[model samples]
Structures are given as structure tokens and as C-alpha cells.
Target: MTPPHPLAPAAPPVVPHVEVPTPRVPPPSSLSLPTPRRRGRGDDALPRPQSVVPGALAALAVSGACLALTLTAPAAPALLVAIVLGVVARAAHAVPASFERGLAWVGRRVLRTGVVLLGLQLSARDVLALGPPELGVLVVTVATTFSATLWLGRRLRVGRSLTLLVATGFSICGAAAVAAMSPVADAEDDDVATAVALVTLYGSVAILVVPVVARAARLSDRTAGLWAGMSVHEVAQVVAAAGAVSAAALSVAVVAKLARVVLLAPLVTAVGVVRRRGGARSGGAAVPVVPLFVIGFLVAVAVRTVGGVPDVAVPVVHGATTLALGAAMVGLGTQVHVARLARSGGRAVLLGAVATTVAMTVSLGGLLAVGALG
Candidate 1:
């Protein structure tokens, strides 16, 4: 009995209740911390030092190549080199976005400078020399070509952007015309690029080939100039083509080309107004201001004519323009891809040929009908 009592007592003493505490977790808000920020789409992350030097060197190399090509082939179309280079650059796909951004910046700057420099080469008297009859012919030619390009672009099922670019270049002063209209149309970089390429290629060919054709057709110097100015897609091309004929032809071509340039402001304004009025998909909103460069161009021309910029300054400006343009061409070439051009081979070539033929025919006909070319 004593032993049982001792064991029972021992069991009862171990029977005390023990309480276990539950662990608590912090609240969701308390546990949560600020997430590390990610770089945004527009962020300009610093490039590695190693990458920077090579990229700069590449850009310089490309620019040097363009300069060499241009110097070697002064009479040949410089625009062609630009186009080829652009195609190659685009195909490479290894080029940095920063390089492209730089190229675009240079292109715009050079374009503005080129426009201003062009004014030094002009005189108010030159514009007035166009006269009423010649003015009428120019107006008619521009209007007709513009309309025809639009209609044909639609008929051919070309993209809206391409159509606008082509029409502006064809109807106005070629590359300058397209460049001016790009912002109004809200054209993409590729659109601007493609248009430049086509215009450059065709314009170059026209400058070299058209003079021969004009001669074969028994067209006079004035006629050749008019045809080249009206049909060619760039001022430089017009000058080149005209120069191939005679000095008088060069004067006529430049004058005709300027007459086309004068139409740029009105055309851009009209397009802006039409876009605002819901003409053709509204094209987003109107830009706050038209391109300032266009105004600068006109102003420079006026100043040159009125202020009488020194004759020596004219050559210097022209040389600067050439260098800047060469730089832009190099930039453009670096963005081009030979592969894309090859893929677009037959179709693009065919389209370009057709467009050129159409432009030539219309320009020649208009010139002949108006007796502007003899």
C-alpha cells in the first residue's frame, strides 16, 4: 500500500497544465518593403567605358568612309552612297540606339544648316525672274504632280506614309520637301529613311541618265533644266543634272527648284489644317509649331538676298553644307541593311522605276505643254 501510494503521488505531481504560446507574424503592410526600381523605357543608362570608345570609333569610321566616297565621286550622286550606307547599317542590327539618335540629330542639324546656306546662293532677283508665265507653269506642275502621286500611290496600294513622302518629294523640292513634311505627317523614322533612300537612288540615276535622255530627245538646255528640276527628287540632283547640260541650265534648274521650295510652307500648313479638320484619319494632333528649320531656310534666303552675304561666305557655307550632308549620309548608311534591301529587291526596284517613269513623263509633258522647255 505504501509503494502504490508513492507511485500514485509521483504521477499526480507531474499532471500540471503547461500553456504554449503561438508565434505571431507581422502584418502584410509591415512586412512589405519598397521594390527596387527598374529602369524605365526612356532611361539613359550609362554605357560601359569599353563600349563607348568602340562605338565612337565606329561612327567616325563610317563617316570617314562616306567622306572618301563623296570626294572620290564628286560628279556621281552622293545621295547614292548615303542610301547604300543606310541600308547596310540597318541590316547590321549591331549598331547602338545611341548612335542612331546621334545620326538623327546630325541629320536634322545639317539639314537646317544646308537650307540656310542655300539662301546665300540666291537673290530676290532670281525669284522674280521666274515671271508670271513661268510661275504659272511651276504651280501647275507641282499641283499636277502632287495629285498624280497621291492617286498613283493609292492605286498602287502604297502605305500612307510612303505615299505622302513620295508625293512631297516629287511635287516639291525632293529631299527637302519630304523632310519638311515628315513632322506634319507624323512619319516614323523608317518611313523618313525609306523615302530618303528611294528619292536619293532615283534622283541620282535621274541626274546621270536624264541629261543623256534629254540630249537624245533634242531638248534644249532650258527644257532639260526644267525637266530635271521638276522631276528630280532632290535639289542636289537637280543641280547635278542641270550642270551636266550648261551653266544657264543650272541657273534655271535652281530657280525652278526654289520655286518649288517656296510652296513648302503653304503645303505644310494646308496639310496641317486638313488633318485637324479630320481629313484622312486626323493624323493625331497638330504639332505646336511647324518645323523651325523651314522658316530658318526662308529667312536665310531673304537675308542673303537683302543683306548681301559676302560672296566668299557663300562658298564656305556651301562647303560646310557639303560636309554636314556627308556626315548625315554616313549616319544614314550606317543604319541601312543590305539584307533588307535584298529582300525588297525586285519589288522596291520595280516600284522605284515605275515612279520614276511616271514622274519623268508627267514632268516632260507639262514642260512641253507650257513651252517651258524647248
Candidate 2:
């Protein structure tokens, strides 16, 4: 050690040079922090269009087959055939979860659209031509059949939804009426399937039964047609039954059936209003008191009445409506379980038979009362 001068700037003690590492901050672009995804109202986690294709295609295929069958056979009810195919497919477990979104879309949106188009088939002149006497008879017949079926269904201890569906179907336009009433009633698919099945079964039977009875009663062709139109559950069945008599009968019968179809819009609106009121009281999701499609249906009817859609386009409109409805039926049918239906279907069968009898009896009696059978 050397002695240091007292006041001299003593050499600074040797200090080691230490390097301080600079804090390394990465650029924002290179930072891998996850930003939260903000979902829009439309992002409700629905299936992609590609994912929905398979089910939609299947339903459309089935509808096409049904339409072909009806066109070729002239006796097959396309909607009935579609639902049967759906039921068979369901029983075989052919429907997968992936099919759900598309099937649901078909069942709801497509069905409603079809129903709106259905109104295009009728004109005010066609409905009005039935005359007050005939129209009065029509009203009475529907009311009696509907009320009796409802009472009978209650006695049979049928579920309310099934009962309502059956009552509507049997009293009005068969499967079409069932479809219309389902949403208003908030019915299960099983109920709708059962109701439709019953309508098909009994309406088919009517095709055989009505012609035989008409002959036995020595009824005129026009009278037979009127009877078939007034009482039968479906348009196809009415056609088959009336056509067995004469071409003139067929014309009368179809017009009569169209008149019945006209009542559907009002009935749905009334039921929807009632259901909406009930839902409000129960704190349930509010049902549309008058569903927009129903308004569309009325508009379609008015359009047809005013000849807004030309007669040339009638076939096209009708074909499109049938296809849409057939597709919807296929979707609804897929939801039905045969095992479950079999277990509960017996009471429905009995109700259907009784309803058929009531419809026939009331309509015939009304015709006689009004002397319209001539």
C-alpha cells in the first residue's frame, strides 16, 4: 500500500465495470396477448351454412320423392308420404344432431312460408259460390265436429295438445289444419305427428267409405261430391271420394274444401290471441297474437281473390306451396318416435273415428236441412 497525499485528488479506487442489461420490451405486433372477442347480436352460435346443408338436402329429397309419388299415383297424399318417410328415418336413427338446426328451420320458417302460399290456391269467388245456405251448413258442420271431438278427446284422456291438433285436423283441412294449429297451441312434435297420422288413416278410410255410402243412398253426383267435400279430412281424400262419382262432383268438392281452408287464418289468429293472453298471465314467452305469416296468408288470399296472381301461375304457386309444406312435414316427422306414438296412439285412433262419424253426420244433416244436396 502507498501513502496517499492529504489534499491531492487521490486516484479513484479501481471499480469493476458491470454491464446492466437493458429491459427488452417486444413490439406490440410481436406480443401474443389474446384480445377478447366481442360478439354481435347476430353471432348466436348457430350452425354454419355448410353444416346445415346435409339435413336441408335430406328433407328436400324426401319432399321431392313424395311429390313424385303423388303426381304419378294421383292417389297418394304427398304430405302424408313425407311424414311417413320422416317417421321411418327417425325410427332407424338416421337423423343426427347435426341435422337439428336445418330441420328446425324447415319445421318453423319453411312451414309458415308454405302456409302463406297455401292461401294462393283459393279465390273469393270460389269460396263465395258456395252460397249462404251452403256456407251456413259448412259452419255448422265444422263447429259440431270440432266441439264433439274436443269433448271426446277429453273423455279419452288425451293430452291437450294432441286433442287440439286432432280437433283442428278432423274439423278443418286435415294435416294442414294440424300444422296451422301447432304453433298456436304450442304443441309438441309428437302431438302433431300423431294428429297427422290419425288424419291420414281416417281420411283414407273415408275415400273407400264415402263412395260406397253415396251409392247405397242413391245420392246424386253433385250431392255425393258435396258430402265428400264437407266431411272428408283432407283435400286428396275429398278428391278421391268425389272423383269416384263424376267430374262435376270433383269440381264441387274441391271448391268446398278450399272454402274450409279459408277459415284457417281467422282461427289461428283467435287461438294465438288467446294463447298470448295466457302466456302473459303465466310470465311465459309472449306468443305473437297475430303471427306475421298469418297476415301474409290473408294477403295471399286477397291477392288470389283480386287475381293479382294470374291463373297461369296457379299451378306454379300450388306446386311450390306443396313442396314447402312437404319439406316441413318431413322435418316434423323426424322428431316423432314410433315407440312413443304406438304407446299413446290408441286413444287418438278412437277419437279420429268418432270425429269422422260426427263430421259426416253433421254435414249430411246440414245438407239435407238446407236442401243443398240437389
Candidate 3:
């Protein structure tokens, strides 16, 4: 009907569909997947060099400081300084874990190395020179004092391990005696540490006080030396106490103390045997074996007597060993907190004081009775 409108009538022709390309998505990259780096045998084999250097430097510093103080304070006693340093280290937690681990390693593995070095300082012949009478006196005094201390420790409620350590240390040698008995007694680190501190403290006091008392009493050098060696808790203390009396006294005291140290193994073994029997009945692990360091110390003394070590090397090695021990002592001291010492330790200290007094009285009386002072 409207055929009239040619332009409108024509209408638009239908358009054909055309295909268009869609954006391509790239496949996930290999790097994008999580991959754990494998550790080669070689990679894990070596210790990180950087981590060890600091610990080495710290140990060296501690050792150097200890030596410097010893040199500078010849009159004041170096052990005191070492103890103080150890306490400080403990308080500040300044010692690195690596250094602590190293010290422990040395203490357990290379302890004999220290003992061997210490041997250059003594001889069996020197020990034997004291003769049977003096030896008898020394032996009886050590045994009696040790037994009395242990008895008192039990009565006083001191821990069993601590009591053993204190008794052995007091009766036989000082630090060496404690070290020998520590494992056998199943002493914790803290127990050994506390015992060491007590020994060190009292030893220092004896070193300073005994000579003054001896001088005032007008005792002979040999008498004073015997008294100091028998009463003091440490070899260093005996030496220091006797030296304050006189050089002659120092010589006597050191020899006497060394002789006492030689008795450590038998004494500890006896204690261990007793402990093992008791533990067996109680259904506990057997007592630990006596430490080899004590044997090493005895061997070193024998070797020195037999002329095994060189003279110059002796002093050098001795100095190094002493420094290491001092450092370790400092570490031990630092582990104790004053608060803890005050809280749980007061009773132990009291027990130690009583034991020390008993030891001193018994020793002095025995010495006088035997005419050892003359």
C-alpha cells in the first residue's frame, strides 16, 4: 500500500556476523609455583664462619681481662676478681650461648688438658717428702673433716648432692675435689655452682685471715703452712694463705694441699660405691663414674716428677689453664642470682660456715697435738 516511499520501502538489508579474537591468558609460570631450595651435603657441612668469630673474641676478652687483673692485683688475690666477674656475667647474661657451650665442651672433653698443664707445678717426690707421720695427720684430718661435714649437712637439710660436694671439697682438696665428686653425686649445675662459690669465698677469706692469725700467734712457717693447707678450701687459697705467712710456708702449704688432692679418687670412689648401693635398693640409676680429670691430675703430677714436661712450657700451659678455669669460674658465678641465693641458699651457707669452723678447729687441734707446728 505505501509502495510510494521508495527510500523507506527498501529497508535495511540484514548484516552477517563476524568473529573477534578474545585476549589469551598466559599459562602459569614455573617460577610462580612454590619450590623449596634443597640443601646440599656440602652446604650444611660447614659452620657459619661469622657466627663463631664473635664467641671466640668474647672468650679471648674474658681470658685477657682475667690475666690483666691477676697481674695488676698481685696482692689482692685474682680468684676474687674472677668470682666477681662470673657473678657479673651471670647477672647480665652477658656471656654468649656459644661461649658457654664452648666452655662446657672444654670442661668435659679437655678438662684433662687443664689437669696435665697443672701437673708441671708439682711432683710426687715432693708429696712423698712430707713423710708418713705428716701424711697420716693429713689423711686423718681430711677424712674426719669430710665425714663430719657430711653428717652436719644431712642434719642441716642441705641437699644430698650439695652435701656430698661440700664434704668432699672440704675434706680432701678444694675445687678439684668438688669437681671430681660432682657427677657421682648427681649434682645439678646450680648445686655445683653454689658449692664452688662457697669454696671460693671461704678460700679467699682463709687466704687473707689465716696468715694474720698465724703471724699474731707467732707460729713457725711450717706450722702455719700446715694449718693453712689443711684449713683452706682451695689449693690457690692454701698458697695464698701460706704466702701471706712466708714463702717457706707457701712451699709447705702447696705440697700439703697437693698431697690431699691425690686422695680424691679413693674418697670419691668410696662415696660412689655407697651411693650406688643405696640407689640400687631405691630403684634409681647407678651412680656416675668418677671423673677422669682427677686421674689426669694425678698422672700429670707423676709425669712432672718423672720429668715429662719442659720447664718453660710448664708455666705457659699452667697460665693458660688457669685463665680458662678462671673464665669458667666466672661463668659459673654469673649463673647465680642474688635473690635466689638469698632465698634457697642461706641455709647452705650456714651449713658451710659451721662445717668450715669445725674443720678449722679440728685441724688446728690436730696440728697442735701432733707438734706439727714445730
List CA RMSD, all candidates.
7.4, 8.2, 11.4
Worst 10 residues of 1 by lDDT: 39-48
Candidate achieving the largest TM-score: 2
- lDDT ranking from best candidate downward: 2, 3, 1
Instruction: Give the runs in model 3 whose Cα sits over 4 Å from its true position.
Output: 1-57, 75-80, 96-100, 103-116, 280-285, 310-312, 372-374
RMSD of 3: 11.4
Give each model's whole-structure lDDT: 0.66, 0.84, 0.69
Score every model by TM-score.
0.73, 0.84, 0.77
Cα lDDT tens digits, model 2, 207-294, are 9988898889888777788889889998888989999888988999998889888888777777778777776321244666776787
Q: Over the stretch 200-309, how does candidate 1's per-residue lDDT look in tens digits? A: 77887888777898889888888788777767877778888899998988888887777777777678777766765664432344452456666776687778778668
Tens digits of per-residue lDDT for model 3, 1-374: 55556555676789998898998766655556766544322211223445445543454466568777777876544444665666677677776776654444333333234444565567677778686767777888888888888888888888888888888877876665676776677765567677777787677777777888888888889878988887888776787788888899888888788787777777877877787777632114467455556667667777888888767776676677676666555544545576766675877887778767776777777777778454
